[model samples]
Target: MPSFLGSLRQFVLAPKLSAVTFAERGFPGAGSAAAERLEAIPQAVVCGFEWGIAARDLWEVERRLELVEQEQRGFAYEGAAMAFTVRDAMAGGRGTRTRDLLLGPAAPHLLLAYIGIGFAMARLPRPLWRNIMPDLTGTLFYPTMTWLAVDGYGFDLAYFHPEKYIGKQRVPPPYPWEGRPDYFPRAVDQGIGRALWFTGGAEPETVTASVARFPSERRPDLWSGVGLAATFAGGASADGLARVRDAAGEHWPQLGLGAVFAISARVMAGHVPEHSALACEVLAGSSVDDAVAIAGRTGASPADADDTMPLYEQWRNRIRAELGAISGEQRKAS
Candidate 1:
């Protein structure tokens, strides 16, 4: 049974935090405020991550999580994971539970669980993160905290669902009806991009070094991950983005593609992170309006695995086209 505060949190604050229009109305000191909140997220993620590491076993971890939730304060930055981390933290290190929640029929629950893992990652030392993830499926589809990027993207979409989809008051469920199993890798790619944003902190070199720890194939994913983070989290300077792109070598295109997605997502959401607009211009030679136009056409629906893949591809293609167009313009200008 859920605790009283936990139930109230899910039914009340979580929905509000996930609401489409919550962040649209910027507050005074909104930039600083957003940064502060973003910082807190990693703190929560690490706190939960550390607990998982110290636990004797899965049972112990879940028990400690529940105790912590009993005293959890209301929504931190209104992030879905912030309010619901405990629910997902309970499933940490349990392969069966993780699989059932993420890939099984109840996959809507996957977002919370992945975010919980981010929380777990936050607590674990940077070195241990590569080895400690719970292998839900037989394969490691989401290396590091890449899976959470799917949730990060989904949460933003769901938050704006009512406004974007019209008459959709409730945030859309995390799972689409036409679920695409193949989409997992792509989703993980997005998550890795998001992880880059968090892990990079104030330094692009930190991001580069962090990506270096992963296998070479993951380099593209890591570069793109940083791009996504810069788009939403908004701290990368032009010089910094350039350094990252140069460091990417063959993977530069992937990094640019990741930036396109992040920029588009932010535009469609009606909120661009501070400096993200500049980052977009510097990295993509594109404006937020371009992103809004491309992202606006996409819609959300519940679908099965078979149906979701094509849609994701279409979205990818749309962003790629925009990217190609921008590259052409930059070349012509030069």
Candidate 2:
């Protein structure tokens, strides 16, 4: 992917750093520090995408990505993986760019890298999506984390085409992701929920209100997305996360489920930023260790009984049920 042409491609195809700013995108933000912090997330994505597209080798990309701050480094890998996926797709599925990324330098952050593939999915047509996710036969969370790519596509749609997906609340048609068209929209909503956290500028009132504008049934998935983004991305303070959690009310369990998933990803990355720890304590109502434990305890296996639901949905449902039970226990103790 390294060359003058590749650099030109990145320059032409990727968004400018300025373009990702909240104000540039017309997303709500008071220009507060938190808002600025939130805005940097996408900018990091741009940086990663550029580097990935232009680097001579995975080692070069990996070395360059190390220069990114720890908290945002995974995001750079995310961006790089995105570029890699696009390259692979463009090469008519012959390039090993994306597969090498996941199995090599981007391995630790496989979770975010999966989402990066989804971002590429949004850009490439349905036909090119065939071989995007590399075959990670014995990996810890291959097929499961692949769902995050669908989540990424949802985020991409809502992020770039707010008027259609977010404002008008259009339901995008389903793809048979992992052979489940019925669950595709639900997975996409999870990503849209994540985008809402950013679209509303990490402001609790605006984020929740945006979710509310969507139909009632959709709000739960949306809230969980909010929970995941608001936690993992960390634009809000402790107080702000608490407000986001409290705002969920009946949807609190869904929100907590999202937070738990975020925590699990962070933990797997082998680093937990201060904001994530705070989010776990506040939104997830547990320390990082406990949240990870809850996620692990409720984790579903492909062998889990009942052939009705996909393991991915079953995994989420299990987490929500655990969070719900924990919430119930607290209610009684209080």
Q: What C-alpha lDDT values do all the predictions have?
A: 0.47, 0.87
Question: Lowest summed-lDDT stretch of 10 residues in model 2?
Answer: 298-307
- Candidate 2 lDDT over 1-110, as tens digits, reads 56888778877888888887888889887488877888778888889999888777788888889899978888888899899999888888999988888988788899
Query: What stretches of model 2 exceed 4 Å from their correct place?
Result: none
Model 1, 140-226: lDDT tens digits are 223322345343443333222323311232222233212344555445444554555543453668667766766676456556666
Off by over 4 Å in 1: 1-78, 81-179, 297-310
Worst 10 residues of 1 by lDDT: 70-79
TM-score of 1: 0.50
Decoy 2 TM-score against native: 0.96
lDDT of residue 278 for candidate 1: 74
